[model samples]
Target: MKSRQIVLGILKSGPQTGYDITQLFQTSFAFFFDSSAGMVYPALRKLEKDGMVTKEIVPQQGKPDKNVFSITPAGEAEFAEYLHSPVEAESVKSDFLARLMFGEFVDPERIVQIVKDEIQQESEEIEQLQQRLSDYLPSHNRCMSTGQKLAFAYGINSSKTEIAFLKQWLQEHPDGK
Candidate 1:
């Protein structure tokens, strides 16, 4: 999904300032998608211009002004339209797959190291997903939060299973000794 669509989803939840959106992105959307403030700000402006959202400037005592955005009825309609659209194919750009495909020409030891590094990273990601689940599963008020929690759980479990498969593959190789 494009960053614009993701931002619109966030705004649909409630009115929020640009800074708040950035924080939300870093905390929640970091797993599924990411966008910089540069992208978010421009997208917000375009959304406002298109009548999908409205902006309000809040004056701060000692800091810069904050631009808060709230989704309109049109925005909700647009979001619903997008939700009804068919899912798009995922982009396939896996570096590990590319390496494994051409691995006959590469150093076997280095490939093992690469696999080790990837598993380590996935372990940390799974930990983060676990934390999100613990915080949200039983009592989160937001419906989307529950959806997000389940999605993260699925992702974390899938990654763990893949890692296990890779570990088994490495173990079966004599050179892994």
Candidate 2:
């Protein structure tokens, strides 16, 4: 999904500043969606310009005013329409996968190192997501729902698969491990 849609869908929960939205991306949406810190502001501006959202400047003590975004009725309708639209196919863009595809060009030792590093990173991510799921599931009035929990489960499962694949690949391309 587009970052604009993600931002608008988030605004439906309540008004939030760009920082707040980015934080949500980091903590909650990080597993499934790939939103960058830079994407939030531009999406907010476009939404505001399109009258899909309205912004309010919230005053803070000893800080610059925060621009909080709220979804308009039109935005809600738009989001509902998006929900009705057929699910988009996810486009994979993995540098590691690409590198592995062209493994012959790289040194075997380097390939082994890369897969090992990926396994470590993926394992770490799985651990973090497990912790987040634990914290999220028990919270009262949590932002996440059963559907979101399922998504987290999917991520955990995918990460497990990735780690397994990497291990096997490393074994096949062994360089005196």
Candidate 3:
């Protein structure tokens, strides 16, 4: 989905500053969507220009004025339309996978090291996801929707599965041939 749609979806929850929106992307949306201030500010400007959102300047003591954004009726309609739209195909852009595809050209030792590094990285990701799930799932801190919980489960499970596959492959090919 486009960044504008994502921004609208976030605004649907409530009005927020651009900084708040960016934080949500970094925390809540990090697993499934990649966004940055560079992307979000522009989308916010465009959405404002298109009448999908409204921006209000809020002055702060000892800080810069904050631009708070709120979704307009048009933005809600757009987000609803997005929700009804057909799901896009999953896009996988993995540097490790690309490197492995050309493994034959690289030294065998390098490939072994690469696979090991990937396993470590995936393990770290699984840990972080588990921790976030724990922090989010409590009744007092239930910020994530059921759908988000499911997505986190999928991410953790997939990372575990990938690590298992990599370990088994290493075991089967002890020589890294």
Q: Give per-model CA RMSD.
A: 2.7, 2.4, 2.0
Residues 1-177, model 1: lDDT tens digits: 787777788888889888778866765676666567677788888999999999998999999988889999999999888888998887766788888777778688877877787788888988887766565444446455567757776778888997898888788873643
Task: Give the range where candidate 2 is weakest over 10 consecutive residues by summed lDDT.
Answer: 136-145
TM-score of 1: 0.86
Candidate 1 at 79: error in angstroms?
Answer: 0.3
lDDT tens readout by residue for model 2, 8-110:
8889889888998998788778878877888889888999999999999989999998898899999999998998999999988888889878888878787
Q: How accurate is candidate 3 locally (lDDT)?
A: 0.88
Candidate 2 lDDT (Cα, whole model)? 0.86
All candidates in order of TM-score, best leading: 3, 2, 1
Model 3: how far residue 148 lies from native, Å:
1.4
**Model 3 lDDT tens row, 48-117:** 9999999999999999998999999999999999999999998988999999999999899899999999
Clashing pairs in 2: none
The TM-scores of all predictions, comma-separated, are 0.86, 0.87, 0.91
Inter-residue clash pairs, candidate 3: none
Best by TM-score, which number?
3
Model 1 spans > 4 angstroms off: 132-145, 174-177
